[model samples]
Target: MLFSESIRIAVTALLSNKLRSILTMLGIIIGVGAVIVMISIGMGVRQNVTNSIASLGSNMIIVTPGSTNQGGVRSAAGSSQKLKLDDADAIKKKIKNIDYVAPTVNSSYQIVNGNMNWNSSVYGVTPEYLNIRDLTVSSGSFVTQSDLNSRNRVAVIGTTVATNLFDAANPVGKNIRINNQPYKVIGVLESKGQSSMGTDQDDMVLIPLTTAQERLLGITYIKSINIQVSSADKIDMVQQQIEELLRQRHHLVGDKEDDFTVRNLTSLMETMTSTTTMLTLFLGSIAAISLLVGGIGIMNIMMVSVTERTREIGIRKALGATFRNIMMQFLIESIVIGVIGGLLGIACGISISLIISKFTQFNTVLTAAPTIISFAFSVGIGLFFGIYPARKAARLDPIEALRYE
Candidate 1:
């Protein structure tokens, strides 16, 4: 028989038992949809992370005090006061690719302005901190070098702090008391909603580093140093140069660990992206198990079909239908079922991803790769699982099949 005739017969068989065909495709539908949703969410998270990090600054690097081992107990990074203002100054002066270096000291205090009182984070930093952090002053001016030199009690408030303390009024030139020390508000920073870690980025206050050290915290050491390199391609070279410079300055010998840690955002981003990709693959694998189960359903139904059509197979064989023709008919039927299921699954998966994105906080991104892979895989499953049943049908002896009741 011709291939067209076989396909017509296969499609007719499926159309006659529409409900059973639909039921058999259920596994593929669910599996494909689940995989798409899972992968979309994973990709979305990775993209969000990348965007958040990029928004901080271009080619940014951070230096913090390293861990210290004391009596077999290791302290966390930044627990030591080894990172000082001198260290930040040295990096700024020595590093070749460095654009801006801002030493930071942080404290949490209750801020009061007239009748309003709000608790917020206070960061002590230099004028370069604004450029390093990609922050802009919406009103007034940032803390100047003169402020640091004179130890002036001046402050720059983030949007959240401004709103909480001054309401609709302009916060510039207002006095806000931090830890009972009155500091004049010099600027209000532009709003930055939140960081990738979910921390409120616009809830802090900025002041001169000297003021924070001498007047507020009474500590000479800084929390961390934020550095922006001139270009991303030169970050590795700059990081290495900074490390060696710090090691020499700290007087570290052979095999002796340095007192500070230097980290580049590029490496951090790559690590995070790899972790998320692995998670996406794992989720996709788990969802594929259902597709396998669906393939088994198709095979089982085909086996039962062979048994029901035993006498019909005998008649066709006796009428000169070749074994290849018999096999092709069954195989085409399974493939048809798979193709239809795959199309429906793609539609269902896209709709589900969109719905989840709209209704929840999760970000979902639907791309063409997953959809194409899923559809192709579903069809391949049909061919793989259909083989055994098709071969069994084709191998039936005409005389024995005709004897069945």
Candidate 2:
């Protein structure tokens, strides 16, 4: 028979057993759908983290006091008192690559503006904190050197805080109380949404580091040190130089343990990307097992089909059909089932990824490559599993098949 005639025959046979064909493709459908969903989530998570890191600035370097690791258990990033305000001042005075430095501290307290009250986090940093956090003020102005030097009890509020505390009223020059300590609002920072770590950035208060250390927390040790480099191109040199400087300052000799660690956000981001990508690939492979099961389902159904059509095959051979024609017809039928299932799987995967991106804050992108690969994989599965059944059907003896019926 011609190829078209063979296709017609194959399609007719598949249509005759629609319910069986659909049941057979179920495995492929589930497998492909699962693989797509897992990959989508993994990609979304990676993208979210990348965006969060980007918002923090590539030139930003975070310094926290403490040992990093020992015996697979890590101490807190900023648990020790090795990082002092003097170290921060030293870096500012000495480091050429460093453009800005801010010793940081934090506390959570109920902030009240007249009758309105809400609990919020208070960040203690110097005037240079804006450069370190990659922040800009939307109204009024940032904390200046004068404010820090004079230990001004002025605050820069986030957009959410701006809305909450002042309502429709302008927040500049207004007084807000943090744990009943009054601070004049000097500025309102632009909104930063939520970070990858799930912290709301638009709900904090900012105060001078000196005031926070003396009046509020009453501690000389800074929890963190934020530094802004002049340029990202100088990051590696800056990181190395800072490490060497800190080691020397901390009195580290030979293999003696250093008390401080410098965290380069760019390096951290690269590690996160590499780790997430590998994990996503692993998860994708695990999901591909379902596709294999689906392929097996096709083979199982094909085997059943060959058994049912034994008499028909014998009669067709008696009526002049060749073995090759029978094989092609059956193979085409199997492939068609796979193609249909694959298309459906692609559709389902795309829809799900879009829904995730829209409803949640993560970035779930459905690119063309994965969709094409998924469908192609489904079709390939059909070809790999269909050959055996097709060959077996083609090898059947006309005389034996005829006599058996």
Candidate 3:
């Protein structure tokens, strides 16, 4: 028979058993859909985390005061001593890679103006802090060096803070009391979207670090330092230099541990990427298990099909159909089942992945590659399941098959 005739026969056979074909393909559809959905979610999560890190500025290094310990092991950075304002100046002057270093002090207080008192966090830092964080002032200038030197009680406030506190009033030059200490509003930072750290960027206040330290918090100890590296390539070298500088300044012996730790930009990105990829693979693998089960379902159905068509196979063979022709007929039937299932699986998978993307926090993005890959696998599953049944049919003795009522 012509190859086209064989295909037509195979298709006709499967169409006659619609319910069985659909049921057999069900596994493949669900498996492929789930794989796409889960993997897309994973990719989205990675993108979200990376964006969050990028928002903080890749060239920036955050120096926290306390050592973060894991289990019972204690790890420290530059100095065991509290980070101070003096350290910021030392880093700026000593380290060549360091473009600018700013010290920060934080306070939570009730800010009041014109019957509008909003309770929020207030940070005190130098003018350079705005540039380093890529923050902008819309209406007024940032608190200047003169402001820090004179210990002026001027402040820069966020948009939300401005709305809540000043309302329609021009906030610049207006005084607001923070922690019962009066401060002059010098500038307002344009709204920065919420950080990955979950802090609303537009809900805080900024002041000169010296003023905040001496007047409000009443503590000279700085909480953290923000260091800016001049170039991306210089991060590792600069980190090493900063670590060494801190170690020597803190009087650490050659064999002794340093109190400070220096972190780099790429490390943060790498950590986030690896973490996201692993989670995606883990989820995708779990989802792929269902595909295997679906394959088995296809195989079971094909076996049943072979048995049901025993008489027909015998009749064909007796009518001068060769063994190879019979085998091809059965094999084509199986491949058709697989190809159909694979196509349907791809469609179902894309729909599910898109639904997940629309409703979830993940940046679930679907690519053609995974779709094509998964569809191809579905076809493979059909052949894999169809093989045994086809072999059994081909090997059947025509007399015996004809006798199988």
TM-scores of the models, in the order given: 0.93, 0.93, 0.90
lDDT for each residue of candidate 2 in 134-232, tens digit (9 for 90 to 100): 898989988888887888899999988888878888899999998778999999998888887577889999999888888888898899888889898
Deviating ranges (above 4 Å) for candidate 2: 68-74, 360-363
Worst 10 residues of 3 by lDDT: 75-84
- Model 3 ranges with Cα > 4 A deviation: 68-81, 166-170, 195-199
Alpha carbon lDDT of each predicted model: 0.89, 0.86, 0.81
lDDT of 3 by residue, 173-267 (tens): 88999987788898888988677545587998999999998888888778778888888888888878777777777787777754555666578
Q: Cα deviation of 196 in candidate 1 (Å)?
A: 4.2
lDDT of 1: 0.89
Error of 3 at 322 (Å): 3.3
Query: Candidate 3: what lDDT?
Result: 0.81
Q: Put down candidate 1 lDDT per residue, 285-359, tens digits, no spaces.
A: 888888899899989889988889999999999999899989999999889878888888888889999999899
Candidate 1 backbone collisions, by pair: none
Error of 2 at 136 (Å): 1.8
Summed backbone clashes in each candidate are 0, 0, 8
